[model samples]
Target: MSPVVLFDAALALGVLGCAALALTLRDRTGTVAAFMLTGLLVALSWLRLGAPDVALAEAAIGAGLTGALFLRGARRLGPLRARPPAPAQAAAAALGAAVLSAALLWAFATAPAESLYPPRVAAALEDSGVSNPVTAVLLNFRAWDTLLEIAVLVVALLLVMTLSPPRVIPDKLGALVQPFARIVVPVAVLVAGHLLWQGAEAPGGAFQAGAVLAGAGLALVLGGVRVDRRVLRRALTALALAGLAVFTLAALASQAVTGALLGYPDGQAKAWIIAIEGALTLSIAATLCLLFTGYGRRSAR
Candidate 1:
């Protein structure tokens, strides 16, 4: 086999192995670790498929943030004493998986050889006002979809707040942690800004940039950097809601200006997209951080 094929085979095997390991591991932490590994491998798969944006998202949010959340939950759960599922349940699951796989394969085999959307997108790209096709698609061609996604995040944040999950405070890691945070957090911020700025022309965008910022926030939280709770709460709330609010307002404004929802005026699409993306970056970052931290630390009664 060619080197590329060989590498792909290895990656595919690694993904499957890690996924199986995660499912079967008795230890919660080990299972979470394995799952995270699987996510990273999946991110690599996305890269192999020529989707760097998806890969970045998979690595940052799927693997990094999700793994941290799982780790925190695992620590709280303490011990694992649950019995395994019955044999019948396992058989049913296996049968379901087999059926789904067969159906997907069939669909793929029967599908049209060429997609119609690519040409449509390419034709409309000049008017979309962004050099990056991905950005144009996301922020212009299908902005309604993006709007709904932001709304979903807002709903999730509301749900999290309603449930009021307990906080897991990080233990101090010593003097080294402060120095580490000082260096890493600033760098993460810069990286996030770069990603946001380049997203209109490259693989980086609001989601990826926001996730990076959230990662930095997580580092600070984990590093035991102290902040005033009331102030932090207000700031996070504002930042978390800002993106959706701005997006909504923009949509309305666009409607008023162009007579179509989310439609930008001629020669102004890029400006609208950039403004919306800027707000989204901060909002997504704050929302993710708040979600992971369970809306910040609270005093234990």
Candidate 2:
């Protein structure tokens, strides 16, 4: 068999295994784990298809960040006990899922290869000054998508905040974790910075970098590194709005200079994109950290 055929078979098997595991898992946490695994496999498939940008996004946002969110949600919901589904309901659900999946597969398989937006995207790429076409699409040609995605993130954070239970005091950690966390957090932040900066020309970006930083912050919280409530709250709010605020301001300013929102006039496109991405990275990190920590007063050491 050809290598391509072997690879395709392996990918298909992996995806099927994940789907089966996800369906059979009784525990919510286990199901989420399966889902994340599925996402990782899908990302690998994307890479095989020669779409590294999509693969990066799938691995980072689809698998990593989303898995984190699901795990956090499961933790908040507490112990999971699976209730046996009624046979009829289970059958109905299975049928529906099968039908939907088949329809989707058929549609995709039959769809034309031609794209209406590619020419426009290609034309804008040179002027956008972004090497990656995906980046150019998100930040330039169709910036509205990026702007809306930011709004969605803000809404998600707000929803999490609203639904969160009242403050629960955290357990006092013994001395061992604090020193380790202190050292690790700074290193993680440094890594996140590198990822964010390199995103312009690489696979890492604001979302991925932010998630890495947030993961670091989450470690600190879990390890009982002290955080003042007032400080944390203020920081969370600011970071939550930072991306939207920066993007909005940039758009408004661009209107006057370029006669188009988010259109950078002259050669300042790269600078503008970097500035927005930096702020977005910070905001995303803060929001994810806060979401993981839940609503709580952090003890000030």
Candidate 3:
């Protein structure tokens, strides 16, 4: 077989094996570890599909953040996580999975070869503001979808705030962790900014930038860095709202200037998109970090 086909076959086997192991693993922590492996394999599948943006998202939110969350929960739950599911529950789950897989296979097998949106997007690219087709689609062509996605993040943060947020790190690794974070967080920030800038012309964008910033935040949190609780709460709330506020105001401003909402002025699409994405990246990062912080039982709350 060709190298590409051989590689794909290996990746497919790895993904399937990991997924099955994740489902059958008895220990909660081991299950989470297997699931993380599956997520990484799925991310590689996205890369193979030639979708770097989707791959980045899969790596960041899917594999990275999810693994961290599961690890945290596993640490807390300990032996309770290993409790076996009811036999009926396990059987039902298996049946559901089988049915869903069959349905998806049937859909794809019967579907047409062509898509309806790509041609339209290509035709409209020149006037869509950003040079990158993905960026233009997100921040210009289908801006309402982007706006709603940010709003969903805002809603998630608000929901998470119903519980106490982090007051301190769960377990401080060591003095070495602080120095390590000092080295890594700055680089993460620089990379995030670069991704934001590159999004206008490449596969990077606000989501990827936000995910990098969230990783930095997670590292700092786990490294025992924290602000006053009140300050942390207010700052997180503001950051969580930043994207929505900026995006909504921008939409209004656009509507006032143009005849439609989110419509950038002629030839000024790049500038507008950059400004919106800058705000969005910070908001998404903070929101994601907050979700992690509020996930489990709080200490001394």
Candidate 4:
């Protein structure tokens, strides 16, 4: 047996074990932890399968950010009090999981050899000017997907703002976390910028960069670095709208001048892509920060 094959087989087994443990874990905290572990393991599996981009995504957005969200939710929900599962219910859950797993394994083992769309994507990439097919697909061929994803983010922020109750900062928590925020926020900003720039040809991108920036902003808020409401609100709203507005305008201009939406005039594709990505980076950052902080008026102490 080859070492590569042996390693892949081990990773596959490990992923299955983690999945089963996550499903069967009685404690909510443990379940969340297991899920996070599974995400990390899945990232490793992606690396083993020669998908480094996917591994980066799984590690960052899937494992790190999702785990942070889960931990925060778990904290809000407080300590879990375990309840015994009824035998019949447990049996049914197990049966459902087993059936689902079997179906997934069968599909993986029996799927057809050829993909339906890869060739079409490759054929279109020359016109898009991005060497990476995924990048071309995301930013050029299927730019609409990116546009709609930004819209979904906006809707999510609006929903959170509408649903969250008004909160007054507690003095104790504010005092405790402020010092750490002072040190971390600037570092986070730097990291976000690097990620955004690196995303042009690397694994990092607007979404990941924005999330990191938002994390910093959330830290500042939690630490009671008071925000100027009018400034923050106006700035955030503009940033949130900038990506979509810029992209739409670019697409419309292209259509008028070149006859197709988002179809750049000769030699302008790279410029347009970079411009759109810059706007997207800023917009995504602002939206994520606002969503985390919730809508509120902040005044200096």
Candidate 5:
């Protein structure tokens, strides 16, 4: 077989192996580490599939932030003490997994060789007003879906708030953290901006940009940065809601002008998309940050 095929096979195996290892590991930290490794492998698979946008998201949110969250949960839960699975239960699980794998392989082998949607999307790209096919599809061809996704995020934020989880106070790592944040945080902001702007024509978008900004915020928290709790809370909540509010208002404006929700005027699709994406970036960043740090106020350190 070709080297490329060999590499692909190894990556696929690595993902499966890491996932299984994560599930089998009794130690919480080890399991979290294995899961994060699996996410990185999945991100590589997405890149190999020619979806860099997905790869970026998988790396940032899937591997990075999600791993952090898992670590936090593990810390809170303390040491693992659960007994190993019974031999019979393990055998049954193995049998069930084998059956599911076989079914998936059979479906993949039987799947059609061609799909009709790509050509349709390409044909509509110019009308959608974005050179990037993914962006066009997301912001124009299927905008209602994107709008609903934002609404779902908002709902998730509300649910998280209702729980009133305690704020995350990062353990002091040393003086190096302050210097690290000073250098890294500014770069993260610039990178997020670039990602948001280039998303119109490149493999970057609001989700990726927002995730990066959230990472920066997490870093600031870790570095023991201080800001007034009241102001920070107000700002975060407003920013968290801004995306849905702006998107809804824009949809209404579009309906007024073109008599269809999110239908941009003949010459203004790009503007509409940029405006919507900007709001989404802020909202997504705030929402993710809030989810991580929680809404509880911590006295300034």
Candidate 6:
């Protein structure tokens, strides 16, 4: 156990080191690479602390989605790298960082281990229709919060759609990348399904599953695969809106039966939650892919 503790402590230090390198690195691309590494290390720390769900989220979103976003947007990134500040400015920055870190530590020390929210979630766990407390809380106890979160995604997609034009990824991604993508894309799809299915009982969930699918979609894009514009629009819209539409419909249906929004019928909550998660997985993938690469503008093969 002490050895395990030492390993965890070492991992935490590694995470901090990677984060520092990410922030301080002069090379823009290297900085982004370091950021991705930091995210992976943070995910490992989350696993060490016994939070697989958070670990998965950090890996998928913080490392994967965010890194892809940075690379994708790199086309617009200016060639100018940030210059080092004056010594006085650097000292001010260091002081600000220390203050923030101290404040965070203080807050963590003062905060209770278990709050009222957890007890409520625990009390309702059996009736929440999911064995996993995190899933139950997100989908049952705080379904409205989840709905709002989905809405935020939709708004982001809409904003991106307005700003970005249809994308046509270059077809000449070296021979090695293309061949590797062919194998990876299918496996990622399969893994996404597994994560979605396992979320009901474990750390896997719609967000993680959707992120995996988005990663596959990104690979496909980079491999010169493009769907027709009309086809792409129809499919992406349907897939991206699936979650919001399904959840809203479910809420209305629940209101009719239980006199409350998103209220699942007795003994049928699991099915409802699962269905909602499935649609969300699709929606999230579509939305993310769109944000990364924009709409396809060529003929489908």
- Of 4 and 5, the candidate ahead on lDDT is 5
Off by over 4 Å in 6: 110-115, 165-168, 295-301
Instruction: Write model 6 residue lDDT over 18-44, tens digit each, in one string.
Output: 999987776778878999999999998
In model 1, pairs of residues that clash are none
Model 5 misplaced stretches (Cα beyond 4 Å): 297-301
Instruction: Give per-model TM-scores.
Output: 0.95, 0.86, 0.91, 0.81, 0.96, 0.91
Clashing pairs in 5: none
- Per-residue lDDT for 65-148 in model 1, tens only? 999988887887777888888999989999999999999999999998987898999999999988889889999999999999
Highest-scoring model, lDDT:
1
> In terms of TM-score, how similar is model 2 to the real structure?
0.86
Full ranking by lDDT: 1, 5, 3, 6, 2, 4
Q: Model 4: clashing residue pairs? A: none
* Local distance difference test, each candidate: 0.92, 0.79, 0.87, 0.74, 0.91, 0.84
Name the lDDT value of residue 194 in candidate 1. Answer: 98
Model 4 deviation from native, Cα RMSD in Å: 3.8
Query: 1-301 in candidate 3: lDDT tens per residue?
Result: 8999999999999999999998787788888999998999999998999998888888988999988888877766665435677999999999998999999999999998887988898898998777789899999999999999998888877777765544335564766998999999999999999999999988899999999999999888888786775687579778889889999999999999998999999999889999999999999998988888784345621
Q: How accurate is candidate 3 locally (lDDT)?
A: 0.87
lDDT of 5 by residue, 1-301 (tens): 9999999999999999999998889889999999999999999999999999989999999999999888878887789888778999989999998999999999999998897899999888988878889889899989999999999999988997887677787777897998899999999999999999999999999999999999998898778788986698779989999999999999999999999999999989999999999999989999998888877544221
Candidate 1 has an lDDT of 0.92
Name model 4 segments beyond 4 Å from true.
18-29, 81-85, 165-187, 296-301
* Sequence-dependent TM-score of model 1: 0.95
Q: Which stretches of candidate 3 lie over 4 Å from their true place?
A: 81-96, 165-168, 295-301
